[model samples]
Target: MGVIKGIEHVGITVPSIEAAERFFQQAFGAKTLYALIEKGGKSQEGDEMYDKNGLEPGTRIIAMRMMRIADGANVELFEVEGGHGATADAPSHMGIHHFALYVDDLEEAAARFRDAGGTMREGPIELGGKEKGPGNRCWFGVAPWGMQVEFIHLPSPIALDDQASSGPRWLPG
Candidate 1:
């Protein structure tokens, strides 16, 4: 894909950034790197921030924190003054429904998720085809901050590897 490299980070909006950071830390060992816009406020004049960022009028950027989980994409949590925290109940909902994380041990991650106040879907549903490979168990859960997340563990490469152009997807180290 040329020298475009890859995604550096994914921005997520949360109502309570403190809780979000704590949840990610306790659930997945996410480490906070630094703060970008440490303070949250409006542009105060000409709706500059809103019009410039294409944000709705009066949407103030509360705060932002950069984080890393293993070697995956950096997680940027954004706290906005007018942001509404909506939790999705199904994967088919509109927009980006969820983000998946690779785990070496699904059970341990689930335990941490539960301990962090996340409500996980019942059963560690095992995939039945070669697409997901063998010994692959996928579990879905809601983060304490109302974000939907998936934890997947694949013991071996999936059959889809043969049909890929990007080779194998990146896994956390």
Candidate 2:
């Protein structure tokens, strides 16, 4: 098996890249690195690029923006003009459940997210016991395009087994 390094970026389809960029900037202080638009060509259909990805023949990537989050994760916002597939129903969906954004203040972040046009879907509730760490709080919010985003505040370091070869190193120090 090939050894995997780490996540380079996460791609999310949005109705409008501008709106998504505004929300990310206002809510999470994300910075937009760049934006681009891709036009479909002959190779987009009939066993070509678009056909292989289930996109329509002349599907156009109307708007795309690459933004860097606080923790250095790059979020690629795509606005496809002729894409195929419906947004996941969330929480109950079989695919990606949600993408989490770790913050220092969960409550404040949730409030900002709401102010930035995000709808709160679940709690600012604390995790029970020590399964997640003391006082760790989490909240779920839905983006304008129906994507679920989670905000979490975990101040305590997670305990790892001594025999474990490697542990997660993505958390902010």
Best by lDDT: 1
| Model 1: per-residue Cα lDDT over 1-173, one tens digit each | 69878778877877677888899899889999997766644322214554444444445556678999888889988676653423242111122457889888888989999998898997688877774666888899998666789998878777664655757765655
TM-score (all chains, Cα) for each model: 0.80, 0.76
User: Would you list the clashing residue pairs of candidate 1?
Assistant: none
Off by over 4 Å in 2: 1-3, 38-47, 51-58, 86-96, 128-130, 159-163
Report the C-alpha lDDT of model 2 over 89-125, residue by residue, as the tens digit: 3111122447988888887888898899888976887
How many residue pairs clash in each candidate at the backbone level?
0, 0
Q: After superposition, how far is residue 29 of candidate 1 from its true place, in Å?
A: 0.8
Model 1 scores worst on lDDT over the 10 consecutive residues at 86-95
Q: Choose the strongest candidate by TM-score.
A: 1
Q: Over the full model, what C-alpha lDDT does candidate 2 score relative to the true structure?
A: 0.67
